[model samples]
Target: MPLPYFGLRARISLAVMLATLLATVSMAFAAYRLQADETRNRFELAARTSFESDLKQALYQIQYGPVTDPATALTAYMTREQGISWALLDFTSGGRPPDLWEGGYRVDAVVRRDDTPPVTLPEELVDYARRSYPEPVGKLDVDGYLVYFGAATDSLVLVEFYNMGGLNAELAKLRWSLAAIALVVSTAGVATALFAAKRIQRPVHAVATAARLLGEGELSTRVPVRGRDELADLAVSFNAMAGQVGHSISELQAKDRQQRRFIDDVAHDLRTPIAAMVAVVDSLDTADAEVRSRSARLLTAQTRRLARLVEDLLEMSRFDAGVADFRTEPVDLAALVTDALELSAPSADVELRVHGDVTLTGDPRRLHTVARNLLINAIGHGAEPITVTIDGSRPESVTLRVADSGPGIPDELLPLLFDRFVRGDRARQATEGSGLGLAIADQNARLHGAKIVAANDGGAVFTVTVPRGVTTTG
Candidate 1:
């Protein structure tokens, strides 16, 4: 089984913060241990020094001469050491201490007899002191604390009691300080971890947001690039990817729309020809010689229309597939527009309006094909008095504007007028157009790095913008 995945920022921040916390805890524990050991060492040294000095002084007093009372001397020495209590026993002597005077106030002391059985130190003392100290020492349990001290002699042993109260107070202060430091350190560590994680996570978050938008079909949304690092590279790559995907999808949609239009136009164009052919054949079968001759002509006319539609479809397909070629030449736009107008005069009721003279280098045949398609579409769909213009002189370029006074196209259908095999609904159901005239015109215009646009404010006007290129431009 796979382990569940966590976010990058959270995982990094948590791991770093936890490691820092653990290290701090380990250091704090080590410091506490060292401080405790130091405190114990200091107390042990003081105890050892006091025991050696005080006991030596008492023993020296006896060695010099007969000491008056050793127990009294030991107690007086211990009482001076503040909080230090001691007990001393003389294993040999059995007598009461001589009276000592403090300004006429007599102090009494008790001494154990030398012949009395000696008090045996506890076994815990023997074991602990033997392990903890090289010197002869004793630890007697007093309340809850173990008092550590040395015993000088079997006959006259001197031991000091260590007060646990002071040690406990010091340890409590240490713990409180450690706790405060840990809290401060932990807070700082967390803040630092969050700050670092945000710094690293910001770019990733932006990328994610952009991705979501892109998934929702917003191809233009892009991540804001920051540093010159991997994240910036990712943003750049993502933008490029979005552009390619958007372009491909747009192209596919356009192709699909074109295909649907092609099917509709083919069906509409075929219907009239097929219906006329049926009518003509019926007439030929039943009519006399003159009627049969007329029907044969009608049949030929419908066959020509069908043939024209098929040829247009094939030519448009060739252009779409990039197989169409241009035969380039130097062409005079002034004469070209005039000739195109004269040739279209037979079909068009509108008179061509001449404009400024222009000349260009181009393929005359393809350019003528573009002009014929435009003029034919205008005459076929529009009313009388169509206007055609030619502009550009020294640059050898041409601009043709064809306008008519017919009922203008609807604003809704104007955008799709140049698409393959698209015709007005009324025209598709009633008129006799192949619907490929404007489509072919638009394609030919694009073949020369040109474009065509339609407008119908007062009447329908089509403009074909083209450059005078000797070699067919894209």
Candidate 2:
């Protein structure tokens, strides 16, 4: 799968954090290395200086050893600085121990002193002096110290060692301070990343959510433009696009409905005249044939139904074209229901009962159509005894309900009832009809600023609710 590109906020934030972290860590490491090198250099210098001082004093005193004290000089030198340790050795032998010295700090040694039994310092310190100062042999850094003694004279060589505790402590403090600074910098970077990320992602996220809603069939949802920035401009453009899409969809649907209604209307309207002409001709040409008379009657009956279908389709077209002029006036809904009941077949008596005195601001012709179509649909598809209830005293609106006691509309047809040319029975059989009655009714109702919905309550019920006194132009 391809990776989704997160908006600039995330990208910028990530870049900043990475750059900051890398720089901080790099600087931290550099600081540590520099400090360590300096500390090491300083420690080495101090140790060498102490050793040289001790050695110089020891050599001068050793030359006059028969009368001078070299121990005091060694003690005084070691006391002046913290990082040094020292020892002294007197050798009386004519030749130095060959195996006793190797480097700055000797590893093994023995000393021979006169008048005081043999006193030996650490052999390692002595070896360090001999190897480090190979040229003179008497001046060498052993045990981190410079040594001063003579081979010809019985002399004591002083070795000095430097203390590292204070230096180590100072290095540790520097390292911790650097670490703390790095931590602070890292925290600040994270905070800055969070703030910048939100600012950049919020508007993009809004657009994304709006797009999702549109995809899910909510054409009304739109991203609100909040700024003059690019994202805001994108949102404004999106809203405009959505509006155009909605308008286009509506126009296409209206055209499709008008075309279907036109076909149904032509078929119905032509059938009536054709049947009348056929009847007149058959009566004149075949008066003696009874079968011919019966055929004529059937044709006439079908023709009348067709004419009504065609008339309904034409009316629907007028509404779709925005030319169906509506007369806004107070209509006695009770009287209209009575007229509808009279128009329906008597066998549907129980299915079409009218009740209540509901008045609405609408065109009487269109409201009557709405009532007639709803009743016809109920009676034709439902079991007899449909109950028509009118409640005009609603706090916000008036409701006219026509419910049938027949089998409730199938779940599938409920949503499409107001669609053009859809009949409940035809839908069940996967068949088609002129399919304009309910659609025409819905359009007419909406034209009068009213709304209609379909449901089932022990039967299928179509509820037409009109906002009181509200009238809409065709």
Candidate 3:
């Protein structure tokens, strides 16, 4: 039969209980069989010892001893063995079956015990002896009673029946006792199985409940570890997984907040330039030549500043969209840096040095943008003397470092230095620059399979190492 619905604990407990019950019952059954067989053997042996010798003596007197009647001698033996219900048979017609009697064979009875009723020999027992056994067999289990037959002479066979109601009652009581013990042992086993199942499933259930809670947005839910076992290892692994999930989600949330701030900063910066351009346009209505030229120049500068912010935003969007393709080709890294310096800060006090192979295969446009942005960031935020070094000393990489003797980055902003819209001096005018310079530089360096990091060693030092496999070049 199929069992009812059950959880893991119930299933485990039920399985163990069934196994225990089966084993206990099987062992009890085996013990009962062995004990019952031994007791029956001893019963038959005692029956033989008590009656076989005397039965032989009665037959000898009837056949060859004193001139005594066969019935009288046999009757005397039956009366002597009291308390044992027995029967004697006299096979007539020379012990042959053809004229023995109807119903296979029939024997003349000699039950001479007058104190009790006469015992009738079983018809099936008589027939069995007529066919297979010419003489009485030692013992015969006839109809659950212990019966014995012995042939004292060719024509005279002695039969005995054991009154086993008392002994049968005792054996019945023993069977019940063994069954009771089996039931007790099986019940105990079931109880122990239930306890063990609970012990194992408790922690597993805790982990499952905690996982459900975690999925429902209780990110801090955790299970307590118990002993040193596989379950404890499961708890440790689950806690580790929960920790990593929490960390990744926290990072994503922070990045989301930063993106919102970037949009706000973009809107605020755009407003300023637009407002300045509108004022400059109103000023352009003046009649004086110098003032009109000055307004025109002011308008152009604000427009260019707005254009650069828009361009940086578009570039960052491309990176976020995973579509910024780098068209790589052979380029002189040192010359690119020099060109960027002359373009972005021609008159700024800066030191430049190139060492080892300064040639690499990369997109010249993006490289130029990276070099230009770093130099601009240094000039705008850091104090002189700014030092730019391109060191291709490593076999498979070239390092570019830009160091400026400026106040180092604030401790609060170091971890998020490469994030978008983060400025060195927040109070600086948006007209001075957009804060996407370093962020864009970092994106470009990473896109080119390069590593760029900013740190402070006596000043703000920005280092970028781009892989080139360069050994030597001019």
Candidate 4:
């Protein structure tokens, strides 16, 4: 079968099972070969030792004349050793001498055709024995029997053959037993591999399912952490990513809602001025001189208000599109504040305080706008004695604070203080100042790499902080 068609669990299980089978089969084959070699060596050694001992005794008896006939004594000795057959060749006269004695032992009596014996020495073995007189102790293979040869005297040779039929039968049985064992072990190994693979597959499947849900826009989907492993770490990282994605989606939705509200408010604000101008247009053409002058004044006021609102909206749009131009230069901040205060010309009843001085690199026009907005916002919403503080004590930055003595901004409005069209209250909405003042000031401050913060310390305080050597082009 193609590999990719298999699931992860099945693939893992197959791999483990194959490895186990290979190892088990290799080890079993090696062990069987080693045991077979050891058994063969042990049997050969024992047979050779017994044959040598019996040959030595027969040779001693022949040399000392214990029974007079050497051949007859050797034949009688061979009969007593079971599972061993022997043949004695007397080469005293030389040149293919007849074997004086042949096999009397029977390894398989029932399989034999006659009492003459089933095994007989081959000519090749006899020739080898005759040629190997100086080193007469050697082994030979006759059919399937293991034969050991030894020199009894200078011209007499003793050849003994051992039957290996029983050893062969035992080895065949062991081979079949090993085959059965391998089959059983392989089956068990496959089962164990499957069990282990299942344990690992569950968590992987959960992660896959969670990923699918996340792909389908379920940002809250998460995998349950099961253990302390790399998979668990992956699950944790996925959860963190999902949370970040959810938060980012929420933020985008909020911005979308805020944009809708801003458009609606802009439409409402524009309609008010347009309605007034439309009502006054007909009156100016047919009314008396006194009424015409009053209507004209009203028309001009509404036109100025409309123009201011359009300008503020355009500036805000430039800031939003990140395309506002900044023409920067070094300007004295104290002088800038003084100029803005003079331009505002607050009522004599309201006290004004100024302190400290600092020079900063920024666009004078934008900085003037920021100062004017902050001063106007303070004068319009706050009570008398508006204090403007210029703190440049630090070498790296400058601070311009506009504070007023009034019942500071409401707690709920502080967060939205810099938002466009946000007024202090319904009462403040009736005032002439456009609510875009603070929002514009905030955007301009950001353009100069500065930030404006609002807080209540005795009253509403708006602080503008510009970093040292700020680039205005940003």
lDDT of 4 by residue, 307-353 (tens): 99999999988887888988888988888888887887545243434
Point out the worst 10-residue segment of candidate 1 by lDDT. 104-113
- Those runs of model 3 whose alpha carbons end farther than 4 Å from true positions after fitting are 1-16, 41-64, 67-83, 93-144, 212-217, 281-292, 327-331, 361-363, 407-412, 426-431, 469-474
Q: After superposition, how far is residue 9 of candidate 2 from its true place, in Å?
A: 25
What lDDT is reached at residue 377 by model 1?
A: 73
Candidate 2: deviation at residue 430, Å? 14
Top candidate, metric TM-score = 3
**C-alpha local distance difference test of each model:** 0.69, 0.67, 0.78, 0.78
lDDT of 4 at 306: 96
lDDT of 1 by residue, 186-236 (tens): 888888888888887888888888889988989788777777888789888
Q: List the residue pairs that clash in candidate 1.
A: 91-114, 92-114, 93-114, 94-113, 350-385, 359-396, 360-396
For model 1, the stretches where C-alpha displacement exceeds 4 angstroms are: 1-6, 18-258, 278-287, 338-344, 347-357, 394-396, 405-413, 422-431, 456-459, 470-473
Q: lDDT for model 2, on a 0 to 1 scale?
A: 0.67
- lDDT by residue for model 2 over 71-155, one digit each (tens)? 4544444455443334444443643433343333342332212112222244554544445542233334333233343221234
